[model samples]
Target: MMIKDIKNYLKSVVDCPNWYVGRIDGKKDQCIGVYPARSQPKPVPIAIGGVENTTYNKLGVEILIHWGDAPTDAEEKAQAVYNALYGQNPEIGGKRVIKIDLNTSCPVYAGVDENGIYEFVLGAVIYYER
Candidate 1:
């Protein structure tokens, strides 16, 4: 499925919750093409906390998996997403990422990892904005 499809799928899994989507960088402020496209890719760990076991947490906060060497197919990306949110598959690289949507049902932040496996990947989670 494409990024669009993933958005819908995330809604179902995150209890049909809604979340604000955006691209992020590591240990830095959230960005959305604010700079040039060719600008540095944030030098791995585009996310802040650094993907591992800390990015995923709470009912929200998901990471947008990104890939570079080889873009993952729709099925592969979907499965990886499932594992990240549900924490089912401990695949090679599926860890919590930085900046959850805070608006989605599961509030999974959008961003890639150091390896670039989850390129253009999306995160989800339900947010309880105050």
Candidate 2:
């Protein structure tokens, strides 16, 4: 449910047609990977110090924006994502985005994939509550 919530939130907030979860492939205008960080155990819905289920869930997302050939275009798309999501709380697809704390955004990289598409990549922690 959190995965769907996060994917829907990304799509709604970014207004892009290519939002995805878990994997990125094909020729999408945008791609998102919402997964638990490999460095830590997956987050659980149970409250940190209590047995009861909490309304909040938190996880990291790896975001990639592809703009075909131009680095500037990719940067523009990345900026749009940052503006829409960074540090803002928004309700999306019945879930509430409590906060989006950006971790890092890489510079526009050329030939990011075999398709030679220019891309800007970012990582963030998404906090949400239903």
Candidate 3:
């Protein structure tokens, strides 16, 4: 339930036109976590935690975004994400989110290709009440 709440929160905060719940083929310029092509930006992915903390109802959520052609692009996008969700406790569905903190964010390798395409990952923990 927390994962579902996290995903729903992401769908509300993220500005991307195409949003995927899981990894997408990286063949496109962008995807949730999959790589497909590089010509244009594709869909973005939001990965949810496999296991939840029954004691606290905490869940790990990650958002993958394309870095675009410049380093500023990546930084800007990262800032946008942080600006959108950090420290804001929004009611997701019937659950009240206690907090959503930015855990970690950095550039990640795109599979084995290691191309020059820009990409960064935003990690967070969403805590909610059951």
Candidate 4:
């Protein structure tokens, strides 16, 4: 569900038409893939009566941009994704996203794949209400 939410959000923001969730479809050289990285639920404070409550979930998301033989294009696309998502809070799939913080200052350049596709990786922590 979180991956779908992110994929939908990215679809609205990024220009890429090929967006995949969970895994990258190698058929398209110019595409974006979103997958879950590291994630955990955030525990909330206990009430005065000793009842515990949890309202938020922290999800780590990884976005991979692949551009055929175009390292600059891949990096630029990753940067565009970063600019669109970093520090932004928007409701995605009816979930109230509290914030999004990128793990790196910018997208990391991953080496070209065997198919000669240049790839860039972007990681982010998305905090949203459950």
Candidate with top TM-score is 4
lDDT per residue for candidate 2 within 55-127, as digits (tens), equals: 7767676666666566677777778776777668887667677877777643334356667677776667777
Off by over 4 Å in 2: 28-36, 40-49, 53-55, 105-111
Q: Give one digit per residue, the lDDT tens place, for model 1 in 1-130.
A: 1233334445444331123334434322221111112222222322465555322332323344332334344225444445444533222112323323322333233445553433333334322111
Of candidates 4 and 3, the better by TM-score? 4
RMSD of 2: 3.4
TM-score on alpha carbons, each prediction: 0.24, 0.71, 0.62, 0.86
Which stretches of model 4 miss by more than 4 angstroms? 38-52
C-alpha lDDT of residue 44 in model 4: 51
lDDT tens per residue, model 3, 1-130? 4445555666677665445555644555543432222232222233355334333455566666654556566556656656666778888767777887665544333322255446666666666666
Q: Which stretches of candidate 3 lie over 4 Å from their true place?
A: 2-4, 32-56, 105-115
lDDT by residue (1-130, candidate 4, tens digit) is 4689899988998999789988888878899999988554344555465543556667878989987787787888889999988888888878998988788998999888889999999998888787
Ranking by lDDT: 4, 2, 3, 1
Q: What is the C-alpha lDDT of each candidate?
A: 0.33, 0.65, 0.56, 0.84
lDDT of 4 at 45: 58
lDDT of model 3 at position 8: 60
